[model samples]
Target: MTRALILFAHGARAATWAAPFERLRELTQARVPGVPVSLAFLELMEPRLPERVAELAAQGVTAVTVVPVFLGQGGHLLRDLPLIVEQLRLDHPGMAISVSGAVGEDPSVLAAMTDFCVAQL
Candidate 1:
């Protein structure tokens, strides 16, 4: 059961915002240890979700899980992500794919974000 993890982020025009996501991918890899991980963007940034999915498929991954990095169940997650996932499903009919909830809406994540904001002021 080969599995791959795709970390999807809302793309940024500045490019610098992507650096943190790269760091995040590294951290996730370290934590998970065995699951193959990679980063993908919704827009602006390169290597869109479909492309990442293709890459994972090429690497012989039989299943892939997509993790959205957004803060809420916004239009991107509710509409765009499912569209992308459906497309990928068609494109990779042999591979099993699943999309997880947005990371930002997690309780621990919201608390951490609030802590960071409060500490700054």
Candidate 2:
């Protein structure tokens, strides 16, 4: 079963907002050499989550893990993501899709952010 990792983020109107996400994707891709690591946005972006997942599905990826790059669980995460995932499930029944909590919610991520903040002083 071919598996892929998708760093899902809320896209912004400004193109520069995607720079960090792109970097994260590249870093992740390097770590998982054979596995596919990609970035997909929720809106105001070129490749929306559904579209990216479809592309992966077409490429014979049987499983995908979606990691939300958002700082917190807001409306987009609480409302929009579930609906999208539901539709994706129906659209690609053969594929297994699972979603992790927002990156900001992770303890390690929070610790890292805290360290960065402390260093700013």
lDDT of 2 by residue, 1-81 (tens): 999999999999999999999999998899999999999999999799999999999999999999999999999999999
Query: lDDT at 102 for candidate 1?
Result: 94
Cα lDDT of model 1 by residue, 1-121, tens digit: 7999999999999978999899999999999989988999999998999988888899899899999988899899999999989999999999999999999989999999999999999
Most TM-score-accurate candidate: 2
lDDT of 2 at 103: 91
Q: List the candidate 1 regions with Cα displacement exceeding 4 Å.
A: none
Query: Residue 121 in candidate 2 has what lDDT?
Result: 100
Which candidate ranks first by lDDT, i.e. highest? 2
TM-score of each: 0.94, 0.97
- Where does candidate 2 stray beyond 4 Å? none
